[model samples]
Target: MAARTHGPATTSTWAPPSGKPPLASRIMRATWRGLPAKRYDVGWEPGLRVPAADGGPLMTDHYFPRAEGDFPTLLVRSPYGRGLPWSPMYGVLFAEQGFHVVLQSCRGTGGSGGGFDLWRNEAADGRATVSWLREQPWFDGSLGTVGPSYLGYVQWALAADPPPELKAMVVQVGLHDPHALFHAHGALNLETALAVGTGMTYQHRGMAAFVKATLRLQRRLGEATTAQPLRGAHVAALGGEVPWLDEVMTHPDAEDVYWNGASLGEVAERHRVPTSLITGWHDALADQTFEQYDRLRRAGCETSVLVGPWTHTSALQQGWPEVFAESLAWLRAHLYGDPSGLRPTRVRVHVGGADVGGADEWRDMEDWPPAAVVGPWFATARKDLTRQAPADRAPLASFRYDPGDPTPSLGGPLLSRTAGSRDNRTLEARDDVLTFTGPPLTEPLDVLGPVSARLSVSTDTGHADVFTRLCDVDPQGRSVNVCDGLGRLRTDGQEASDVTVPMSQTAHRFAVGHRVRWQISGGAHPRFARNPGNGESPVDATAFAPVRITLHAGSALMLAAPADGAGPDTAANG
Candidate 1:
């Protein structure tokens, strides 16, 4: 099919098209939809095949005002079908608010031609689509991109060499570190690699086929992720071609050219795009979002961040009203040159804990970590995390880790369906996981910044893994996860000590009477692929091996606390 040739302006007519709600009705339905000065009825334009730099034409569907005047464009390009995130309601909502909304399906998905080889194809296609949009009569030669996850990645790909028409972008949970996305240090997220990747196997196929394939893959995902010699098991679960999955499994090292070519680290620094980032404290990409904001700002790019208190999908679902309002304000100020729409702030974090309906209070700060001092809590031989430093080396605290029965994931930052804080009391009961609980706080202890754990340990096995977690122990003794980190190591027949595991960032207030707890474990099950302790890649290893992890007096966990109030016994930095 040929692309739509939008000609010069003609007298436009407004009407509520058949089987669709009116613009006014939709706006009223929204709890927090931005109301623009100009309002127009939306008109749907579908089956528009935009020609790409690649021979294949990308399929697009536009939802725009019926008014005859050209308007600023908001483009969302993703491998996921356009209806997602945007849905029909959001598509019309944007269009009705006096913007031209373009939903483009990335190559090989949503009937667009070409294989979806991940982020590699986005740069050229994104630039070409911008060129095509510039030619359209409805576009005012200004464009703003908005979406979450992969949709956000497409924006970064375009920002590498931004087209003249490109104005700004609203990135939500964007992936900046390709290495961390797949391999967390030397470990792979088995569920993501096997299940999520498998579900995307039929992206090129029609919706029906894709839906059926995804459903089938998910039903057997747990077993598939645990399969031995996992190099090709994901493909088998997909029951169709997933060549990329094979390639990823075979190459577990981040040093691979494939990861370098796709990672957004270098490309982000190369260009400046007025970007607004909306991320969640519990989202898998939370740390990456903050990292990108800092990097972009340092590179002289105009960037603002809003960190919420929700999971990966919940960030989009429950946070739509909030994030969209901020994003729309950002777009209005940036793309439309209306400064009143946006308030400048380097970082706006959701101070977590003691929440109503899981929503935290927001606080704007000059930087990511809000002027906090590093306070350390040392591990004692008596199995307690303390503020006092050990005067002498104490006896070693011991725990045996068996990969066959790795501790189950109680959820913190994994991208599975169940991705958020879960009660950890049950998980802490396991003999393999060592628990170090602090005394009940008589007053509130507000921790806000990057959290990490340093372990001084000696493992009997040549290769071992360490997983450390921070939790809030309530009055009832229920331990809820706050944040956690995992470290994979290869001792090569020697004992390793002072291992550092960088946990995900968080901004939580431990309420009065709530005791802080740390669960030091070897593995967190399939959330992070279990280390076999044999120097073998997790991609192909399922066999469990027992390793004795001996923790000595020097092991410690630390958090960011206010510098103003501290004691002499508190150690500085981890």
Candidate 2:
């Protein structure tokens, strides 16, 4: 889509055809029927023009309580357009809850003037919107921000130079670093990048356009991921050249000049706005949310976090009730001067049970990580995971990863439909993937906090990627993923390399009769762009090589056991 510049236009109200709700009232009623009782009738005025920093239009929709005297306002700026999910879900619903909701389309989207330049213009554009709010008659100066994904990013952008009226923020499944989203551990997150590109390209157009674009991407995914040069391979799947995708893919280094000022994480350290962060354990941006929480806590900012079991999208759908309640509580406590709705704890996480006799309930705590006991379970030559150290320092396992036939990615943290925990029995059966299974637990074991794998590995190519995962094998012999991470290995001199692969964080309980399994592989293809097995960049490589990886016996999986000593301290086979 070509960029368009528009002269300022008079604010106009747009009504739904047939003079009814934008969507049929019954559909809206059914969708949110279980939510809190409506407090007011929603009044909407669409197509309000808020001038950007450069005088271009930032098209907005105003959802207000029809009988409101004065109320706090919530600002939600998004590039995905103010339709479908956003219209009724955020604009109308939040408005009915007694807050004036201004849902605006980011510049260059949804009839907004000026070309969208990704993250470059958000800070200035957001500040301009707040300035516009100050002139409105209903502006009572009590303000908060809430939304998910890019919407969360915009909140951070605004927090960088927070206006005086800004009181609170709720960032759900948010990310502060775009670089980390596209490139993690020095490899492209190919699938997520493509999915994001597709959404940005067509989602603003409408649901049909977005759905069609997604289908096209799905059809061409295999071909695009396998193309030799890798540079222009995504054009076919993405429908056209996505300049930002190309720029990010080509520049893998986070410190590269191309990514300067792209990360807004510093805002968390500098600002003291009471922020509530929500993310799912399987959400693609879970790590970012953790980072946000840590920074905000360290800066002495009043902050709270809620981690659930849903993925990036599901957090807004299936997890909406919980997410909405958490968000509304935070906004009410800060914006409405009512702490009655707030929870007593600053941290809350949903412990995943998954058909096992585990703690499948919401846990509240004073802080994150909660002082868990750290323990290491070692890998053995017999393909066993035990707290008992290996008797001898010997080679534990070996696998050859061929980039031409790279190991495929299964369910885990991802943006697409194939995200969240999946049975890993098939993935573990792959020749390139090695699994070290612990004996069936005699009792239920709960793992909370961060997980990591410390490996003493040697690769024939001296350059490869290591993918480490922690899984829960049920009594039925089903291996399901919990959390996983990928680390890049590039060494020329060491006989063996000791590297730490962060498996992000998780709150899960392993049931009685379940087993703990540590799975290791050279690469999770297309999940983390295939490693070329040489020093060459995966994107620019036209040649591929295979790497034989050897795992030393002393390598171990480190986990954070609950602080209460409520679980097993050692892995013992039943």
Candidate 3:
């Protein structure tokens, strides 16, 4: 193999021979003489049409190590272009660790033929790809899979009825329930779905103008900004609007349509492969990852879960270096003869607010909601409002929700170009936001795991929406959003009994001076489909009729805290 170096040091492109060491081995030996030297090779080649079981063709780009002899392969099936930075880097990393990597473009994506059909055909295509790899000259008959999000979904699909060559998988930020991830709690995730759909469609088109426009927007607004003018531009450029976007926006419920597209629960029950599952606390797909972990564990499958303190993008930019190392180690141990690495049984999560340089500290346990922890927080409500407390009799507070000027999303894990560090103090000042403050805590309170709110409400109209926000109020009265949940109620569903809605789980420390605050309102616009107030379609409803919703204290809002000791070690208000 040819060798080249773009940096100061000279390095060979391929692994050296056993006796006559190559330049790459010499460079590695010089750098770390006492430690193990790692080397890798990279090159690009044409696509091979792997015949699907159903008589279709799936095109794949083969990326195998040039080290000679047989080697285990790491297959990554992705709807996004095979050459996307994340997957390509993953392929290279695995190859460096002494495994061949195959990056395949899913059907209807990239150079692959046929129309896109989501997960409908992934099982057959993935099986075919694995079979083809096993037949290749470089195959060692062992295989593993790795990728995040959609790529992770493909791994899950293939594992459902795994090929004989499949051995292990590393799934990150993947959805186990499409309904929940797409239409969370009956509310359409318009911003995330639309952004992802549009971005992928643009990639499929291979339009330089579209890529340039997207990059410019991403640069100016940051990756957290979700709202964009490109929806119209993309529709115009594509010559028609994408039907999937509309389907998602219109059907904001867990219906058969979505369930058919994603049957992860069933997939997990049937999967026999060992798997490593990773997720972000703030990612939109966190629920899916967690659900998959739980299901796989129940099915008597060997599984490991890792929850990080970052968002979807953070998995790439901030956490990729360490995560990639851990993942590669896992793959190597399972695929190759390396026996030093083993997957953990319990989940390891970053315990935030630990004052460890604002980095996530890993905590291991036997199961979720650790055996020692119990969930027990009182739901105190008066009239229509609710508060979570061990003992409190505070009256219900009211806040107006104006549709004309709704709450702007300030980043917690949605597909948007906005930066995740937006200050939410200004939004807290609005009259439409009802803020309840708790007295300063006497001791440090560690809040870890999922949060929930119970509310008793009545609406002037038959249909209404409720948005609950959990925030940490610092000494300066700046409120930072920690977690949030929303619920839409029909006229009949708005009963007097308290209703429970789950907020995102987080690890934080509420110090003596810091206070826990709950912001109650009706809606978080654009991020969620707007409630029409007239019981009409949320998307097409243009009429801005106002609806009066009441929260009665003592009868309305209550807070449920995790059982004592269930919170993280320390808490820090963001």
Candidate 4:
């Protein structure tokens, strides 16, 4: 689809205001002044307050051009302060593209005066914000939303209500279920979650207070104090102390509260907006994006999904420009009555591995799960090694899991820092990790979606931990982790086991010279809270001795593989 434009301009007409100022003010003024000077004229207007459903007033900052015409509004509802760098960047860019951009600090955040309650009040507040935007003097009554992570979660929350003015949305790396995201994976993911959560706390207090408090905390308690205290406080102060975080630690089972907040499946069926979701293939939350995409398609919602070879911060790093372009095209088509090459259903992904030259490519399909594949791979274990193939009987393998020196996290989607350069060679050397591989492939094998492993296992103790990793063993013998999945084992059925644990999906091509391998282990430390190997005790129990875990090779650790001729056909036309 293509939209018509008037014509190209031939002029050097726009100029910004002249001034020098403090850094933060300079950054803000530059953004406010420079963004409009190029293609859009940015101007701020005050007195915008929408009444929350509960009678509280919700404050908002509106950014639009001086043009004397009504245009659709692009709304961003964030718990983080609206003036923050990441939040404002989206507002400036979207405003430059001709939408009336409104950035509202949700509930207690920023200039908004209220106590924060996480996602509880977002639905009503978001609807109130949209209704207010629709009634504005220059509003066209059409609205679209965009944001990453927490901000993205608000978009979904608002859409779940199907607000009349809401038309479409772009959500990047947002949480679908708080339980699954923050705790369900049987590990803390403490660093990344805290980095984001504490960042929000810092934003809520303005820059000055945030920095002052930060320095004081550092001096009093040491540099790590700021991050750790916030995390500890969040867990301790959780309403009802619902044991939300602790339950995640103690009960790794997906029951009760964990299932309550998981929203992707529900949002897909309830929200009717045309949506675009972007997530990193390596992201800890990548499963949410994929599951949401599938649910949306099955529910008959218009949607597009993109998974790239980037990490969690892809939006600010190497892939941002392209991500921006795609998002802009979607907004233009739906918001501005312009449509140029926006597809109805597609999943474009960046393929990673030593082969395929590491590039992104688009793939179109009528539905997710692709309709052309079969899932069949069984676990095969011999000695201490495990593999996946068709199996009619059981297999076993064994390893010891020591809580003190548990496996450490290398790199993945949930990590705060970049582990791009770190290799997995050292991790493979540990006795606790079980590694298996197929002979070097004779041709390129492109893996482009979610992966799962099935294991028939029994532990020496009543409980155990399982970590399954997919890796690429290069011709040089280096093993690089591409994707991984994990589960905590409790054999008495108090917790779930034997079920397939889905790992994060990825796009990678295994070259003829490389080997496709799976590494099964007990834990990945720091990235996940350590699984104190004392079988039946609560995770917080401090006293425990390590236990030995055994995997029966004749029947356990099955690797599921694509059916015959079900792999990607490189012989076909690209």
Candidate 5:
């Protein structure tokens, strides 16, 4: 998971250099011709001071359409600073689309006064900013919120008490649960935390400083992640102690009082704001977006979701055209009473193609996880996946997991350049990994919803972690990951137990001749901190041990396929 990143890049293909309208126009025309045409020249105001709840001045930048007409405001709050992508993409380009865009740095970053404390002050500062907006002469009393990554978290924080002026929201690759972001099912998501720490510590300083910090982290990552006492291991990469990172890392327990009020997911249930949730299949926070959509939909709030085949950063780069268009449509329909641009369907997802088969295309649906039927592919001692049930109870596979040499994590849903689907032959070859391969499919199998693995297993050590993955294996034997998840096990001393590991949601097509695969591993290292194979806290453990894990034949891979025509495909005939 090296080179993992969060938020928009300092520079973007969508955001051209300032003072060069010709270059910007040419780039947009060449790459994003489908977007709505620019309607106004943008006006900019830098170094505006907006007071926080406690009178601490927060640095802000306001970008508006130069014309005299009243326009809806787009409030973008981010801790990553107001420059590059934020200015050109959100400030300039969006302003050109006939909206007033206010880009503000969060408290204690980007020249804003006060200490940054992660999720603590966002709600208060958001309210304060809205209060400030009301006093502005140009404000038209209608507001919409938009941003990505941490920027999205700020939107959720603001929605804790949805301002009367807030008519719509677009949360791209957003996060709601701070606990889930850093820890997955009790194991620490080590690499993402480190990358995020680097971003928070240096991004506001300037691009050069941020790049330097990122390079330093990459150089020292091996040393930091392998440190004896995993706690405080990030000091070297981060250049210094980041209190919030330290706090979150140490407090892995979601129920800890230390995390009180850290999650703002409940806000979605309470508000009826027209919201658009955007995420990539491989984005680290894609599950969060799915959760947001589910909550919003269940509450009968007007909502839609767009999922693309991209990683966290790529969603803003390679997928920017579609992302920007979807965002503009949602904002226009909700904030400006113009629904013409809105798509007829509530869901749009990019169904991925296999190396040799499956159609690569965008699909529109009335709702997400669109009426899928659950099908189980049972694992066998022969290392084959089949629709038939196990004949009898037996150990299907066994592997030794050594903490000294843990299984390395390959690409899939990480926040890195290396994130997303990648050939998994190297990973599947590891001694600690057990793979079950299904027969080549005769027909395309479209899996469009959540995938999970139900395993009956026992570990020599009472403590272990299970990492299960679903993959698409093409004709030439290239096994690429689609979705995966990690779950920690705590059993009563070597006793067999049943544990279900949710592999998350995915929209993918397993084409003809492509075989489905279920890969099981003891752990995916640095993507998750190596379990010390003891009961001790993974973060604080200094002693390491080797553990042997066994999987029973009854274990099965569960996939959600469309109720019609989508199911476990039978073996292709000779």
Candidate 6:
């Protein structure tokens, strides 16, 4: 199993000229002189405490220009430690450009006080933190926020009802709703949830401890995921107390007030700041990032999005240069009134497959899911993806799904493990997974936005899990998954005619000579819980049965991709 990238890619669409002024530059600029190379000597003030409403003084570290003058404040709040790259890159990097960078550890983590309750108190806490910054003599009231994951969530929490002094926001892989991450399809992502809970709770155990815990996890993850009664599996595998993990186990629905009330979507109607979102096609929270951006755009908040061929950690894997210059350019425009910082491209997505030298390979679009060339390539009896639907209704495809021996998850938006695209040749060889291949493309096919499939099926079990994968098949027969999704079907007795499973979104170009492939399966273990075929929670269930699934001839895979640059009749019929 060779590692491949199922995520976003870099672009050559735009680059800033060396020592050139802002506004006229590359899409993902590598070099820039817009901000002075060094505007001020850098200085750091650590352990500065600010009074929270109920919690202990929130411990913070400050980075600012040495020049004696008030500077625009760039605030980043996170449960992650506020040091090194987190502080130096964001704090000193931006501070050297004549801005004040303030990094604060959230309520319980880092040097901050009080118990951690996830995102429960972030909105109020964030607002209070900003208020404290206003009292500082060196802060000019102009503020912007940055950071990915938890840091990203803090921005939205504050932006729900932004302060009058709030000027701009740079949201990176922000998860708006906890439900979206915890329960992707009414099933807990057992392995991922455990890793996250342990990491967040035990990260403060010092660097050596962190490394040991990570190595331990890598060694025991396989056994932990398959544990019976997964309720306390993390404690046995990770050996740490993570309060929030139990909450996910107890409440699987996002409708719970605990989860719903903390969602950015719930308060999105109140968002009133100019914002920019950055994410990868394969980011764990890609859907959430795009969904939040859509909501923010509809709410009349000036917003833009930039998606690259990368994973959740890729943004800051080594350095956040891709996002660094982008954030600085955006914040300068919105906060400092630098007209040159306004990026005209509302949506910039990378085109993968062929990496063009000196070019960004990014397409500038006004909106997502390009207007023309959508298709629902109907499934046929001969195991082929055809542009035409099969007339025969009697030919049905069948597969047996056994919960105990579920299909393993392969790449595609995974967390903790080595992610991105992995060659699917071996996974596809399984008899349980159905394969449907399309004829080699005669023209380049550029896919953008979401992917979906309508399966005409019925199952003996009360609950059935439908997992479908869309892959790009090269001439050599290597089927690499690009986008995929899972849908959990339920019934009182009657199985629905067609269950629609929504695959993850992607922005890749399938060059001519390559074929498109679809893989239909019953489950993607750990990524999604296996359907027991009987009514039993995975937490304490012991019995399992094989589910017989039938996909009638009318089944089809629906996709939305641009043909020849948004030309007409691009819908896939076969």
lDDT (C-alpha, whole model) for all candidates? 0.75, 0.86, 0.62, 0.62, 0.86, 0.74
lDDT of 1 by residue, 1-574 (tens): 1222334432233232333433443544454444343477777776689998876889988777766655678988877675533544356767777677888889888788988786778889998898888677556677888888888888888888888777788898887665666777778877666655754555435457667776777687666666776667665568866787777656768887777777777765755778888898888888788778778877888888988878887876777667767887888777667677565556777777756235446776666776688778988767788998888555457788887777777788867667888899888888988988899899888888889987777778867888899999889888889999888865534354667889988888898888888888888877877788777777777566788887777677889986674311221110
All-Cα superposition RMSD per candidate: 5.7, 6.3, 7.2, 6.0, 7.1, 9.1
lDDT of 5 by residue, 20-41 (tens): 2334433544455456678987
Candidate 4 lDDT over 1-574, as tens digits, reads 2343433221113222222222453365463431223366555543357677676767776766544455578888877675556434666566656777787877877767677765677888888776676556666667898877778788888877777777789888766676666564465554454444445566556666556544443343322222322234443222123223443334455566645554535877755788888887776667888878878878787788876666766654566665777777677777766766475546666557633454445444444444233343334453323234444434355678886666766776663555332578888888888777767778876675667666656666666677888788788888887888777776642222354556666666778888877777887765565565664333344554565665543333333334465543332122
Taking the candidates one at a time, how many backbone clashes does each contain? 0, 0, 38, 25, 1, 26
Q: Provide TM-scores for the models.
A: 0.90, 0.94, 0.82, 0.81, 0.93, 0.89
Worst 10 residues of 1 by lDDT: 565-574
Q: Which stretches of candidate 6 lie over 4 Å from their true place?
A: 1-38, 356-360, 491-496, 563-574
Shift of residue 230 alpha carbon in model 4, Å: 14
Candidate 4: stretches off by over 4 Å: 1-38, 46-49, 185-188, 206-264, 343-345, 354-366, 372-396, 419-422, 492-499, 535-539, 554-574
In the range 1-574, model 2's lDDT, one tens digit per residue, is: 1211222211222122222237643276556745888798877777899999999999998887765256789999999988888887788778778888999999999999989888999999999999999887677777999999999999999999999999999999998999999988988898898889998888998888999999999899899888888899999898888898898888889989999999998899987899999999999999999999999999999999999889999998888988998999888788877788887789888877633433257777788887788899999888999898777657777899999999999988899989998999998889999999999888778888999999988888899999999999888999989999999987553367788889999988888788999999988877778999878989989998899988987899999988774432222111
Model 5 TM-score, all chains together:
0.93
- Of 3 and 5, the candidate ranking higher by lDDT: 5
Q: For candidate 3, what is the total of clashing residue pairs?
A: 38
Cα lDDT of model 6 by residue, 1-574, tens digit: 1212212212122221222111211212324333336666666676889876685778887876665544678888878676534655577678777677788888888878897787788888888998898777676667888778878888888887788888888888777777778786777776668767766776654456666888888787777777766777667668766768777765777777767676777555667778888988778888888887778777887788877777787766522666777778788777667757555667777665634223447677776656746688887778899988778655457788888888888888866656677899988888789888889999877676778888887777767788899999988888888888888777444354667888878877677889888899888887776667786776666678788777778788887766565632222111
Top of the candidates by TM-score: 2
